[model samples]
Target: MEANDLRSYISSHKNIFVLRNKQFRDSKLVIDGCNLYHTLYFTSGLDQAQGGEYGDFETVVRNFFKNLKECRIKPYVVLDGGDGGEDGDDGEFRNLKKKGEITIRKAHALSTGRLRNVLPILVKTVFVQILRKLEVPFVQCVAKAQWETAALANEWNCPVLSNKADFYIYDMKGGLLPLWSFQWNILSLLNQSGEKFVRAKEYFVERLRPRRRRLLPVFATIASNDDIHLDKGSLPNWAKPSKGSTATKDIDALFKWLSKFKKQKQAINGVLSHITDPAYSDKVHNVLTQGLEDYQLYLSSIAEFFTSGTALPDSSPCLPEWTLQQLAKGKLDTVVMDVLAKQRTVLSFPVENSLYSSSNRTSQPIRQTIYALLLGVTDGAYVEEYDREELEITSSRVEAVLPSKVVPNLQLETLKDVKYGALGSVLSYWPLGTQHATSCHLVGLGYKRIPNNLKLSYSMVAKAKQQFFRPRQRLALKHVSHYSFSTMFRPCQKCFASDFWVLYC
Candidate 1:
């Protein structure tokens, strides 16, 4: 039975939730097998395309297993055994088949392309093959997959991964949506067991404590089967009026009243008491009382089904102990460290002299501007007229001394009219620590460019001072009295030595 509108109810109260990615590490995840099949069909885009064969299914399932392996997760897959006598007689199965056919016809009308008829038996067969190939342990339940999965999760103390919203009603420790668009959340039980399951910085629910009494389970079973939608108002009569009134309202009012009590037993008792009262007519009272008894019997039968070994089959496949051991090891740390190493390599500045080639000289002004921006220096002349001239003279001298191929085509004139309107355009190319040095030559050139009467704004002056002094500040702290000439060509280090030279001369 579907727990309608339950997910929406839980979402409205979000303080009780935590993400799955933050907590699922090294945890056993129980997957609903049929749910996975349906999720794959839609999410893999197989549903949208024409002429898709069942062979494409293995690739999607393989990728899913690969992701689980990457995350260091141990998964237990459970598939449903057909019908499982949930339907009272043959008529129910016939009715269900008729409904399925109707649904198929409607789907065909709505679909634009040729839709493959994905039967349960066909999908299950493919799934068994893939599971065996991957060496993943799985089970096929004798009855409904939902209850079996829920019972197994409760027994194993793991979370259930399924698209079914009704898992919330089943009181699973967690419900995970493993779709592409799924967010991380552990829909935990409110009591102490839930507290132990959540990770640091994750949240837990205090309000949704599960009721343990037998009668409350009956209430849950009735609520599950009944088509009556629950809202704020559908509560019992005793919970309605403030301590005195005997008046009764509809199911909506009854639900609202019952919600006030922390325990479901109290609410169920209130409901029972209200319906059994002498104020009601004998015919109505007898019918209501009999319905409650029937509900109790139905609840008992369900309990019997769960306790019976036949209902929940032990269908878990045997796998090698070494394979199971491999699944348990956490690999996220290694993956994360590798990612960090790559990032460090990318962030490290190119220190080689060959990078100073004339072809790269044209990129200097933009690089200098980005460095200046990182240092919070905005008003400074990023490429001073003198610096340009000095570069040109140096390039000419080098060209006369060395072979033509050795001299780079330095384009100092290109930076003459460049303005620093926004550094975002070029910031991506700049290296880490590019902003630490103070280019006093650029700052002095900037000072010279400003008109005497028209003073630069405080923000502009501050940015310029910060850009110019930050590098010197860093160098002074390091006890480095002089900057090397080789490092001088780089913007961050260039500022340091140029500033020192300007100070000494």
Candidate 2:
């Protein structure tokens, strides 16, 4: 391809921002199984990414592993196997597909070999290094059932890692966002036999070298699947409301269980102390509580989505075979028939049915000004900008009115509604921390029906957004403090860090 064409390809993928140079890699680094790794390559830039096959694929893999060692962060890769990909190679279908599994072919099919390439080489290479040289205890899982990861992590007494939005759906535990930072979080409460909820940070530290007095209940008090979509009237299900049982029974059960353990208050106080700087602690507590409250509100919002029948699958991007199978199984719950019939267009896509991953709804388009007081905003300027349009601009535009030329005011209103709709639908299965923060962010944005209990407004929403946002200056500061310049672009590291930022950031 021509240089310009390659450049364009790389630029397009830039939005996904997965570029992580060697500098970021260290034995201390823990990656989020495949999602972040894939995004890094696919989102680095349109030109480079589109010509991905042409690139030195193995080198990319090498650099990814190499960077991990240089960073001093123990690289633990989680094998999600979310597709259920099994051995008969069934075109890399779900792992649930056994050796004898077979299926008829469709005109278009994704390759199974490439799927295998996704992990084995990387895993084997990493394992060889750790088991032979690094002498670190690394953990991985390849289970038929996705939920098995939680079970294995619990049994082996190791950390679990994933980035699925519906992690709350399966109640999978140990949540960590690898690219953002080095910290690990316990994502779920489970059937594991060990002490409930080990903090990932402490767990990893202990793994490096045994430590005394490990804290039990290292996780926060998370509200389980409340299925807010049903409550807010989004999706309908056969299960009865879990709230009554949860409130009277579950809460009491949790507290009673806690009483069985000693140092409950002391443990809580110790965690609080870790975040001690008064101002920082206040923010931490605020965020933690805000996250919880959002979960509650999300529970209430589900009613609207269900009542309106808006939570049905989009099915616009499903894999061809999966789409046909869903059709054969009569799984296409809703479709824009006119569009399908008249155009004979492909309607199926990877339906993001998981609440934790994404929501089907859009957002509201209200014009409200939000002042972003960012650490990196030139001179740490606290610019006050009005929402004159619909676009949500955060980068260098510092403070600008919404509904910019790129986005319409109506689009913003629609987006607002979408967020509310998503909260309603996913609240049932999402963790309290995620759900609560989402709700608070929405309420802070002036969503009309948000209850007074949420105590959210545009300012609060901005703060929540800040948790996810990192000013360029802040990231730059982190990079400088963390590593030397020569190590930044070292070989064998993943290539999509730059792309991931553009899309998600």
Candidate 3:
């Protein structure tokens, strides 16, 4: 329903246009906040946080704002509220519903120990909070965030910042900002002389005729969306065409047929009255309406797919080849490497050693330790032994050794979970002039000292503290409060006290 494949068609036909950073200077930009959030989360590996203070969320938010400010762009971020009713009033709401359905299916899979990956939703609230604290202008749309963003973009005559390929369908005139400038590959297409080559964006915007006709491709994209085919079995007969006939093909045929009629409605009706039976005309109208409605429903479903916080199952034990290639190429940042290391550590053990080892397994004490360490339950299945039989074996002969607490409130289930994000947060709260020389030396980084003598400007340090330290403290406090509400542990007082000191200090 997302019309994801439409991007390929756009690329092949050279429809997307790119503007340089200079072009965006002082420009008003409307953003699809959900789209941007997920993009940042995946790229930065923030969505893996199950609970506690997640610095990656703050980092991603700060980086996003920094990018916008660097470009001198005024941003209006729109967030999806929820799924609105079936009248197709809100695009994001419908999308959320579809995603929710997918999440339910994925959740079932998760319960059965199936390897499924789910999108994270808890971070969006944090993102919105950060935006508010930064005083960035944003709106929580009553319906679909996309429609609100598009409407705002249209009204302000500004570009929309989103990665969704379907934004073209909104018929926005302000154009779209490429999600990230670096993500787009430079596509080469022929020039006017047919002898030279030009960038895809230039070729599409400058050379394409009848600019309004750009929507034609978008319409075609909708008709040929993957969701339609995915849901074809459930689709009404009117929604499906005969063999070898597609909605896109039929729509093209209709356009060709209509070209023979006069442009005006009265003329077309007069021609139809003479050439076709009234019943046939009515039937044709019905079919078109039904097809359009079905398409709308499919679009709604796409919205749900994204909104559903269903983590997809990873069937393979190893990292994605592209990820490995990136690491080999040294394209990954230190932070990314740290995240990858954490994942690698988790996957190093056999499936029987994992927390989600068996279907009939009672919650293990290690689960609580993992929850405390990672600040969230491990919500995924082990890749190597994903089958029901493999997962049904409850016995675990191996014992997990918990790591010592680095700080007052910090408790690590294993040293592997002590990645940069978790360790960095604890390090930030330690007393000034603390050093971990031996550990740093072992890692080939020489002696590591906290609160170094290098003096940073007051404003710089304040901004850094505000962006990094404060949000983490707040999130930790919130998590502590949740723990108290659930009464999950008898040592709540001790835990809260330690959390308070560590977070506040």
How big is the positional error of residue 44 in model 3, measured in Å on the Cα after superposition? 1.1
lDDT of each: 0.37, 0.27, 0.38
Q: Residue-wise lDDT of candidate 2 within 1-505, one digit each (tens)?
A: 1212222332233222122321121123333444444544443331220112212333444554544444344544443322221221222232122111211011011122212212111222222223333333322222122234334343333334443321222222223232333222222232563222222221122121111112212212222221111111221221232233334333233323333335534534433455536775565455444333322211211122223522312233322232222221112211212112121111111111122321111121111111110011212322221111111111122332232322223221133232222122222222233443332123222222112212133343345446643453233222111211212222344332111111110
Off by over 4 Å in 2: 1-31, 46-51, 54-57, 82-162, 166-175, 182-505
lDDT, ranked from best to worst: 3, 1, 2
Q: Going through the candidates in order, what is the number of backbone clashes in each?
A: 17, 110, 20
True-vs-predicted CA distance for residue 21, candidate 3, Å: 8.7
CA lDDT, candidate 2, residue 154: 36
- Tens-place lDDT per residue, model 3, 240-322, is 22223253334433323333433334323432344245675565344334433432311221222124522212223332333
**How many angstroms is residue 302 displaced in model 1 relative to the true structure, after the best TM-score fit?**
18
